[model samples]
Target: MLATRLIFVLSVVIGWTTACTPSDNSTSDIFIIGDDGPAPAETSGYFINHFGLLTTNLEVMKHFYGNVLGMRLMFEVHVTPEYSVTYMGHAQGGRNGTGFQTGTEMYREKNNLAGLLELVQFNVTDDSLVASTKRTNTFGHVGLIVPDIQETQDYLENHGIEILKRYGEPIQDFTGLIPNAFGLGEYAGAHIAAKKALMEAQGVIGIQLLLMVADPDGNLVEIQQQEQPAGAV
Candidate 1:
């Protein structure tokens, strides 16, 4: 009886704990939740399932993400009759990226892995709704996680991409939101993970306008290898 009672208590405690949860992002009441990121504490194995952009021309953006950026073309999925989900990218064989859906639009993986880009398109032919909307975050930026931050920065500058800097030093959130969200409550450990991820990110490619005061023009295009859990669909 004592053992059973102890187990029940443990379960109750765990239910109230953040660490054991499935990362449902319960605090999310708004769209574009962590755009002001070094993301929150729960970011591990999290790749953008989807992000929306506003543009007058889909072809122009596609040329960059698809042609110049080297994101693979997996398949085409319709978000709705009026919209589409263009699977512009994929990655992370182990660290799990997922898919996203909004209204009538839904996107998924070509395979079981994580980390893919889904560029939301309102109308392919006329390009009406998307053109009318301006999708830039208030900070006016794009973000990327490069494998070699220095190397990637150098390459971009050499190519005359005009690397912009908001901070004199590299930007990071050592105590990211993951720890906070999960209540792992390890400040030092979170910092180390943030540093490691920043150091190991590879080859971010694309054009981006930086936003926010923290890291301006940080990275709109990220080049990191992602991962997926075993048997993850």
Candidate 2:
């Protein structure tokens, strides 16, 4: 069913085309046929390397994702006196005996690790560079798979992390939160209702238990406990 839906969506996208004359160095109009465009030099072996978050406070974000969420600190680098980057992930092994490396060592073994979350921080005290509060209608959320949903919820609650949505909670109304694009804003209520129905159905099947919590920077983090396969350990 999922594959069928994906194929239908892809077919619709590929069948549609738009003609536009870009105001660049081009002299002719181009018809964009879905994802068709100039071929890249290397067209294969591509994957999502990592997700990066611009943080106001690196230490606070690190403590939230590391100590609270159990992601290991893979590496950290202080690029300059006012700038730093930190990588955290579920991958095992780090450097020295501290279970993390610094500097350029992480790039050497990048292929061996996956699911890294990069946190970048600029230590300048400029108010323009920092947001006073989190943007509520930004990117959706980062999802993490956990072994026990109830336990994860309890842990996050104990840590005083704000719980956006608990298990079996009704999907909140996001009428104006969604951007008014492609007529999506008008159907926000219907969309949320559909999502809530799907969630209830999935929960009845015991396939997944979900919890959504806010990180230190008010970013949403979805924690899910999925049913393991038979004899899986």
Candidate 3:
């Protein structure tokens, strides 16, 4: 039954392409099989953690992300009346971590994970951005890692932000995409296109932060932010 359904959907998706006509109607196979299982991966992973900004008060942050996004909260921390942290999880905390924060009025301005953004809310210097601006990626933002990328993409579109597909020259691979000069950059690889495609397929939406450069600590920190609509904003 599932195979039949997949065939029907594929026909509609591929416009009933003639190439799909098989030499045999056997349900056992359609494409060549490789004995090798899934692709091998890097030992550690590409990122460490993802951080973001919330527009609402600290309590609101807890209510929406915890109650609404359905993300599990590993822990919560307090900085001040304006600042708080509610760490969210898609899985465990080793490789990738997602969380929420409300203190300095940071708004995420993008729709995909640029990487983990180290938010600096404490004003240890003379030029800290305490006041939130109308349109800025002040502290930083994080993207929701959705398995059904198309679902997320649709959700975002319905909300209002236009999704843009970027094409890379030569369709760059790992070497071209990673920051060659930095050891970590090379490890991270060129996944922006992959992530964008996944997000589009899952109908992805919500805030995405952009990372233009790495911080002095050799970490890629906060850049920009984007908020989801239909109330997640």
Candidate 4:
């Protein structure tokens, strides 16, 4: 009887311990829950998936991203009244990149391993709607992680692209890249900064060099080299 009672108590203790302990094999939330169902995840494997911008000159922008940067144009689409979309990415092995859909529009990819750049142009636009000022750093910017930073920088310079910010330099307007939804202002920012500092001290966090350049439409583009290159998709 005593042995049976001890076994029951041990079972109870084990059950309680298992219940209180955190899970090791738990999976992180990959999709957001909603009333209907989880919404499609916007980001690919990349932390930042893709960004789009309106351009006055499609051909010029295309040449800048395609010819100068050597990125492939995945596919072009014509949407409704006078709007066209072009997707570009670093093509590898002739495979299309990661494909994603927003609303009714479907965007394709050149490779699933990285994010993409979407270029939009309006064929018919009123003068009032078409702002004279181009998309510039004043608004915000997109960042890219490449294989080789110096080589990419040299290529841009040889193609007459001005590098606004050099590598290892603190990116001006860094907060602009972060969405306002992150709630990272003041107190939160200080807390995060402190945590990051602690992580860096412990060698838990890594750093990457960043370079800033302006695209054809004067849009600021930030590019960095990936610490490790991903295999072809």
**In angstroms, how far off is 193's CA in candidate 2?**
9.9
How should the candidates be ordered by TM-score, best one leading? Answer: 2, 4, 1, 3
Residue range 15-89, candidate 4, lDDT tens digits? 545665558844333122357564467743544545677786889999998788756766788887688998876
Backbone N/Cα/C clashes per model? 35, 0, 26, 4
| Global lDDT scores for all candidate models | 0.39, 0.59, 0.36, 0.56
Top candidate when judged by lDDT against the true structure: 2
Give candidate 2's error at residue 70 in angstroms.
1.0
Best by TM-score: 2
RMSD of 1: 16.6
Specify the poorest-scoring 10-residue window by lDDT in model 3: 165-174
Candidate 4, position 107, lDDT: 30
- Tell me the deviation in Å of residue 45 in model 4: 9.8
Reference-based TM-score, model 2 = 0.58
